[model samples]
Target: MIQLYDSFHQASKDLYYSLTQAGFQGPVVVINDDGFLPEGVTSAYSYYCQMETGQGRSLYFNQLQVPPFWEITGTNGDGEVWDYSQRKAKIFYAEPKHLRRIKNVDWFGPNEKVRFTDHYNRFGWLFARTYFNAEQKVTSRIYFNQAKQEVLVENFMTGDIQLNWQGKVYFFDNRVELFRHYFAEMGWELSEIWYNSLSTPFFLSYNSPEAGQDILFWQEGIQEDIPGNMKVMLNSSHVRTQRVLVQQRQVYQKMMDILPEEQKAKIAYLGYIYPSLRENAGRKEILILTNSDQIEKLEELTQALPDFHFHIGALTEMSQRLMAFEAKSNITLYPNISQKQLQRLFQECDIYLDINHSGEVMDAVRKAFEQNMVILAFEQTIHNRDLIPAAHRFDASQPTDMVMALAGFAASYPQMVALQREETSNESVTGYQQLLGKEER
Candidate 1:
């Protein structure tokens, strides 16, 4: 019998389907944390990277398909082998005819119930295996995704790796071309490069020196203009590391004014992303930076302002209900737009309505301000409120009030231009580079 343990769904499901379609027969054990997976899925997705060759003939691997680590030849009569077997990801044979049922057991041994708590962080799995030149056991920091019955296993751990690759010019280039260039320089044939949005990690392969670098992902405070994918960095097998970077920045100077002892290091005078501003080519465009959470607010605002062109830059997929608003000619909703496309929108729009969800100092709002677009925020934090002008700020708790204020502002076009003047500009994030490069005189 053959079995596969898949820890993630995105690309893995496609892999499974392709395998089954290709006539490969095997029982698959997958992460069932959600408890909603169809029959045939078992929750124990940990990589028992080692095999007990004395008792069993087959060696097992967890999620993503990998190059094999070990092999065995037919045992001799004297408990010795005359031949060697090739190691591979496929589990050619196994001890069990049927998929093993997980019985409320911990990886160490069996129990009456599942040992892992719902909120358990994954690095706690010491039983999980990491393979180096010789099999070396290392702990991983992976998140348990309950809904999809998924976790990233093996080389798919996502984290950020910053290699000073001949300075930062390579950072601005395309992924495929840059990788091709790297391989060309190294004189290696590039067989495959795989990365997906979900739990499956990315792999950059060549030889020992290029393989095990860590990839960093900024989780919490990301004040940069970047693509939807670049926001996260995951751990990969060829790549190394287990933690995600949660970068936080204090945007308002008033925070220091309130603090008796100002932590200069704590706050960012200018946030990430060098601003590229444009003079108001003002198209009477009103932009709203939003995500899935604020559907109702977005709908109401769009319906209320039928006369105005409302451009909703959806950072992520919102409900179909809000998506339905595109039926109205006045509302334009953009889902998962590219960084360049978003920048063009910023340059063209006249007013930026940042009725964003709570706990966000949205980089979009800042980017719009750098372009001298009128900034309006609702239910923003004190830190964000201080950054936005009083004339433009409104209480999101009262959606009607927010709409009315916007309506009033729209009626008074001259007032909008005056508010832009009242708001002061500081040295952009580009200038911060000089400050960072400066030496104490």
Candidate 2:
């Protein structure tokens, strides 16, 4: 069995975890090589680079090997490499500070024009380099082997790829063809294929005759109509796709409502089996993880609920305006919080306030959801609408409504959580086992 995906985003990661929890064993192959992936997930670039398993050191900002005069400054999200006063490059991390390993670096030329980006593997090797044109458009990308030799070259303008393997040279018209070649070279039996995308992975499964059964774990959202590709997978008998599992309950219902009865037979609703980390202590402790102090109506909410304790934490130091909240008897502040502290907060707190502005820090909304916290937010301040149910969201102007909802939740915590879980559609291992039609190994 093989698990194929175009990219390893949050949805893809959830699918991987869900499959593993259901006792499905397979090799995961990602088409895009962002250089930062969870353990055991391999990318096409990694295979071309001939990266050995468990090899190479972790690449850090200080060891980036920049110019002698360049200095590196760290921030909450990423690091900046500066040449004297001018910015030279921006360093990104898979997990800032905690992982401390370099994911990629964007280099700037004269007038701070983007020249190219160097993608580094977590194993600390430069595996790929993508160049940009004067107009800031991607021109080409070069994939490197462990010996630092060019193994493949991709042209963005023409959608072509040139591969140099062993002593032979091969050319492909597009990425799909290049990926198909990679699978062929790997010499693995494509008997059972599990994929999560309706694009490249769908095409590969549709075309590969060796694949006996194809299960598509659809992660994308659908609106009034089902996607054309998904329709093809469900309606067409010529394709190998045997089942289409929708990860979101709402999307699955929409698809079911639109498709015919025969097509509906091939579809099922599936959700991630998130590990429960929360304990219902009836403490009424609320947690807010933020990168900015622009928490909408924070003072109003805090003042409205005198009995509830608000715990606000940040990866960086808090400003004076935010620090003033420390004077509140029911409010606590955690500046420059550590991972251990964050874990403790997630466990101790039963409710999470998704009211902070600016970008989310450390995927906080998902973390809170996984911790089984009752997440509430103002519609404007909510970062991820998918995880936050519509009923839990309120208007920014109606602070009283939010306060009333919080009071109600605090009054009946367990009942509210049960309703929240039902809306979120958190699944179990048994659901996956039935979908896969196999017992746990």
Best by lDDT: 2
What is candidate 2's lDDT per residue for 52-151, written digit by digit as tens?
4638776877788887877998765788898789999988887654456888889999988889999988789888899999999999999898778999
Error of 2 at 131 (Å): 1.5
CA lDDT scores, all candidates in order: 0.41, 0.85
RMSD of 2: 2.4
Error of 1 at 355 (Å): 1.6
Residues 1-441 of candidate 1 have per-residue lDDT tens digits of 122222434234433443343343444444323222334433332221111111211122222222354332221110111113422222211111112111111121122222221221122122222222212222222232323222333232223211223233222132223333444554532332222222322323222144333322221223333223332232122333332222223424443444234222322333233233565554668877664445336677777877779888754565787688789899888876556767777777888777656433245655676676777766542234434667676666777876776676646655665565445322333343353323211
* Clash totals for all candidate models: 15, 0
> Stretches of candidate 2 above 4 Å error?
52-54, 96-100, 167-170, 260-262, 439-441
